[model samples]
Target: MREAGKTLDAALGEQAGLQPTATILKVIQLTQQHRGLSALVLGGVEGVKDKREAKQKEVDEAYEKFDALVKDFNNKAIDDAWATPKREWQDLRNRISSGAITVPESYTAHTALIPKLLVVNDLTSDLFGLSLDPDVDTYQLIQSMYYQLPYLTEETGKMRAKGAGLLAKHEATLEDRQVLAAIIGRVNDRLTQTHTALNKAFVANPALRDKLEAQWQSAYDLTNKVMQLANTHIVRPETLEFPGTEYVAQTTAAIDAQFAVNQAASRQLEIMLNDKVSDLRKTRWIMIGAMAGLIALAGLLARLIARSVSMPLQQAVHISERIAQGDLTAQIDTGGSSETAQLMRALKAMNDSLVSIVSSVRGSINAIGEASNDISTGNADLSSRTEAQASNLEETAASMEQITATVRNSAEHAREADQLVGSATSVAARGGQVVAQVVDTMGAINDSSRRIVDIISVIDGIAFQTNILALNAAVEAARAGEQGRGFAVVASEVRSLAQRSASAAKEIKELITDSVQKVEAGNALASEAGKAMHDVVASVERITGIMAGIMMAAQEQSTGIEQVNQAISQIDEMTQQNAALVEQAAAASESLQQQAATLQDAVAVFTLHERDAGYSYQSPAQLTPRKLSLVSINGIA
Candidate 1:
């Protein structure tokens, strides 16, 4: 009975059921009774039966209370605390997480939920405060039924309201839905933890198996029903809808089915217990009838019991041993409807699961190994390419540096040429000035020659007049004869003198005309020279402008070359960095390959299914270096 109780506890505990919680209460009560399993066995079978019934009643009453609380929560408290909030919250969450609404829209939805401040306040301060506690017990279930569930519902309602607002404005988003999903998940986790605690309590007790199972079923059903309702409330039909509610319903159904299975197991256990009780009664009667025959019959019964139990147990142990050695193909033959048969079946199932897992892991590891090898190969190729690129960039940068220096030199020479042209222009301008002064001097000389010519003409005119006056005196002297002869001779001599004076004046005038002509010619030559000088100055100025342009162009070229060189240098640096990154990537790939190998070795202990029998593993040689085609990158040349 004790072993049966322990087995039941183990099974119920694994399910994280309510039976575990009741089992704890029963254990606490049993300890107070100070009755060991041996005492219960030595005591009358009626006493064991009585204890079982009493415990069953107590457990049934506890379940009845839990069921009543669930009914109240479902009928009344859930509508106010859970339904509205869960509906609203889930709707909003769905919209956000489904990518229908943006973060800002979600915020707007949150703001919209503020109108439900009363609900939020009630959920936080009243329902949550009352429902959730630090300890796990029947009270915990009560709290969950009265407060926690209601709070979750109210919260969901608030979220749903937010979703509705979001849907009105924007579409739902995956992120928003995730956020809401996380909230729901977090709230649901509390229930999961409570369930886990109950399972632990169940595992700690061996007595009160029936009581615990009933209590667990009731509590599990109630909680699952409330969860389903809450989930349904959270579904938004109008906006972004999800199968969250349907999924919860399915989960509840599955759990219900599991509970049914447990009940069946319990029934089987009860039948076995009845059989044992019947045997005990028969044994007691036999002892009462014949004391001598009782001992002999007892020995015979013990032998039969050992043979019936030990043979199957030994076979099960052998199968388990083979399974432990990674032999999943080991066949089990625990040929009875006994607990040993059940255990063997469970072990077989476990072996099947292991086989599936190992096959999956093997495939995954092989894929990983191949991927790591590919990555390593790709990284190596990339590294070599990066190195080549770096070398090319370095060469290009060197070439650009030389070009920059050459351009700089050209600029300097252009500047020097510009300066020289400027100097030549200045010299030409000075020559133009000198020619202008010479032109002015020639003009002054031409003016003086003209004045001299004019004075000579005046003198010539005077001489001519003198000659005419001499002729008139000579005629007066001839008429007066000898007395006038002296006067006539004076007039003739004066006329002769005037003629000489006229000849001299003509010569002087001719000389002055020649001098003036020469001066005018010199002035023309000087003006032409000055013009030539001005042309030279202008030409020199043009040359200077050209030189200046050349200097500017050369300077610009030098600057451009410098910039190109700098850019090339930067490219070289980046290429070097890329090479380093590639190297690091190669190392990482190698590490990943090692890890994949290790994983492959780890799962080698498990036997794979026949379907995976032909699985082939990659060799390390496949990960090694291979001849690769080189690709040339263009440089800045």
Candidate 2:
């Protein structure tokens, strides 16, 4: 029973309805049967880690879905249903969905009572509109009564209560209604004063205040007519025109039908409960039998295990104690059990292994002494070899010094040759005159681009002025008379043309300005590169002049000392700066080649066919617009 209670608590703590109670009962029964399954899962169930992680994920997903369902219920069911139906049904259902209400012991249990704020029977369809269902279940029936009140008081009523009459605190009974009637009298007097003021407003502003007075007349007429209609409605239906009052009978019938369903559900649930209880009784008996069988089996296994295990364990202990007392000569009898005989054999093996281990240790000590003497002889040999290696190392060091000096001179000559080769290559590949011409052209193009940007700026300014002029022209055209109609038409056409021209010109100017700036910047970069190339050429020439003197000095040093001459000769250089320039030029050419290869990729991203133009295009800049933009002569477009 305690186990069942725990299961029930787990399942139904936050659950709802008679259905949920049934579910909880089933869970309890399942738990009782499966008793230690949860322990087994923790112990080592197959795929336990995956199952646990999946279940946790399911639980989190359930929380999110449940939250969404509640929000949906509030938006779709609660707020919407309240607005459409005066019944408390929607709000009650919302509470159930939101987990705000406890699960009912019986599904139809909650609707038995309602707050007095809801005048359930006295409701009008106009105030709390009809539910689509003529008869509702307990949940829906409850919602029907909630919408009626103080509940369905129109916004106008709240507004009236908020006015100077202070109807909110009036507590309108027959006494307060009398006060309200007095307040209404005072309201009418205020209306008279307002009527005068509104009439004066018409005198002050005829067009506007006349509309206000019209609204006042309509509102006052409607209010008086409504009061009269209400009185007539209270007096006799024959004097009233409203035809839908018969729905009251329909509503009562609906409430009755709802009550009938509740009673039926309640009775049906009782029957289901009785059947469940009967099944549970049978289950309890089964559980007791199962428990008895388990207990009996446990006793039998314990008895069997004791006879098999304890005797062997005690015998093994005795043998172990005897061995512990230094009984090296002691022997154990196996009594024909292979496992027991194996233990005896293991003991004998241990004794033999220990004696052998002692003999092996003595041999190892004698061998270690011999190995120490051998190590001493090896160390003497190693020291003799190391002394010879040190002498060779000194010779290697001198060779390395000579090699270092040779590499340094070779590096210098290579640097000079590299520069000269690069300059020669550029001159051969592209003539010096052509290079100078290109540089001069770039400069001229750069100046022309600057002028183009200025022209674009002037055009933009003109467009702005033209727009202003068009606006003024339009206003002038509006003021023109019939005699000036032809002139006005001309002015209107001019204004339209001016607006079109201005917009087109502005767009064109922006395009021109961007192009000009790009060209000017490209020119400046080209000019700087040309100057760098020129400086490299001059530096290479200076190095070539220094190389001759270096070679002559090395020859004189050779006569002074032969070894030092080899070191000085290491200063000889072969290549110069022209080689480095050639490499850079090659690198730039390679980049240009790769860029040409991807021209097809550029075309792939843009669909010329879809553009319905000469070409479909998007700027690379569009991919990362904020990545630093070029500062045009103007500003950002």
Candidate 3:
């Protein structure tokens, strides 16, 4: 750290000394004042890392910077020193900065002993380690003359004082006659020119013309006294670095060489960069093609696997969906796979089973319908037979009632005649007692006979009148329109009934006539009997006491005959009813047989399988109907 501090202090001192400032001595004199400054500057020129770092950090830094990043370590150190110019770099920098002058950076080969442009600077230099031309100090005396002169101020004082300083510094002797005279001559000529310029300037200005001559005369007298003193000290100019034409020639040549080298390097770098860009483009294209080919191969294999497995499975699923929707005709195109074949076989079997079941159900329903129809037919036939039998029985019973009434009436009449015969014989006993009583009884006999004839004639006439009315109604019915044809037929049957009644009436009239005759005869006999009955009454009173037994016996016999007639009539009526029932039943049985044949034809339309579908249609017992355990005609069983 301490060595670094000392180095920093020494570098600062060299930088300050090299910077342009107003001073009497040359740059070499300032460097000689600090021996350490020379060594420190040399070390910085070697690119000491810490010193470079320290310089960058200095505030308000006045140094010009180069592109240190582009240069090597040694080049950077040397270039940085020249970046902001000392006296060595100043003219070149000024040419670049200003438009006052130009120096050629590069030169063409020319026919000259000297170079193209001469750059004269203070540096003691060489041209490629070769020295040339005259002794450098001889021309050095000429270049120093202008620089050594002091600025002329205070009229003549500046030239005299500046000459005395130059003589003292070069140690000019009092006996150096030619050097002294030249110095004296320059001073005298400059003083004369100064006074002339002042006179012309003042005389043209009318305000200062009077003061101008006095001032010049006083300044000239003082300047002569200064020259006598300078004569005492005048010698020669100092020995210093003043390399003239040779120095400029060397620098110009060096600049030309550097320019050529840089241009060649720039051309080479661009060639390398273009080659790298072309190589990158080719390599990138090759890699892209390889990657694309690999991807295409992978995709092809994936598609092959999917088609073999997933596509077939998808077709199978579609087939199943159609079947579930009740489209049994749907078929899968599995391209001849065993699983597809099995599925098709199963579906076909299910369809066949469903068809068989439906056919069997239809067959069973037909059989049940036939059995119900047959039962209904049988029931209708039985009801019809029962109705016919009931009607016939009613007709036969009516005929039997009429015959029994007639037989009963006859038996009563026979009992009444036998009683009269017994009374007439008893009347003889009363004939001797009175002739008048015999005549009264004969008159009563005539009256009773006449009443009997009258009742029988009225009954016969009523029967005749009823028959005529029935015949008249039949004729009226027959005259009605065609719609009354059924009534006409019924009326015709009534007319037949009436005709039979008329015949019965005729027979009844004849019977009545006979009965009237018998009654008249019975009355006559009774009158005669009444005469004898007077006498007979005496015997009859004895016989009526004894012959009441005969009358009782006759009444019992009549009652027996009436009961026999009733029994015969009932037997005849029962026979007629049984015959009617038999005929009706036979007709109904034939109709039922015809209906059975029709039902059999109707049931034959559909087909049924023989295989038992787990149910029976009907029992064999159902073919024969009986009244036993029959069901009602709803769907109960």
lDDT of 2 at 269: 32
Name the runs in model 3 displaced over 4 angstroms: 1-249, 252-261, 295-299, 302-306, 316-637
- Local error of candidate 2 at residue 254 (angstroms): 2.2
Give the number of the best model, judged by TM-score: 1
- Each candidate structure's TM-score, on Cα atoms with residue i matched to residue i, is 0.37, 0.23, 0.16
Backbone collision tally, model 3 = 22
Write model 2 residue lDDT over 1-637, tens digit each, in one string: 4564443332232122333222222222221111112122232333433543443344334334333433443334333422322233334434433445432211122212121112222232112222221212322322322222112112112112212112112122344345435434543453344344435434544543333445445544544443333233322232223321221122223223323333333344344334544555666668778889999999999898778767766777776675565343445565555565566667657745543443444344334333433343444444444454445445655776776566567656666665676566555445434556677887787677678767766766776676677667666766776656676677667667767776776787687777767777777766776676666556655555565456455544434445554543442211123334444544554454344335434333322222121322222222221222223322211
| Whole-model alpha-carbon lDDT for candidate 3 | 0.41
Residues 159-188 of candidate 1 have per-residue lDDT tens digits of 333333233333345565555555456446
Which runs in model 1 stand beyond 4 Å of their true positions? 1-375, 392-429, 469-488, 539-566, 591-633
Error of 2 at 45 (Å): 73
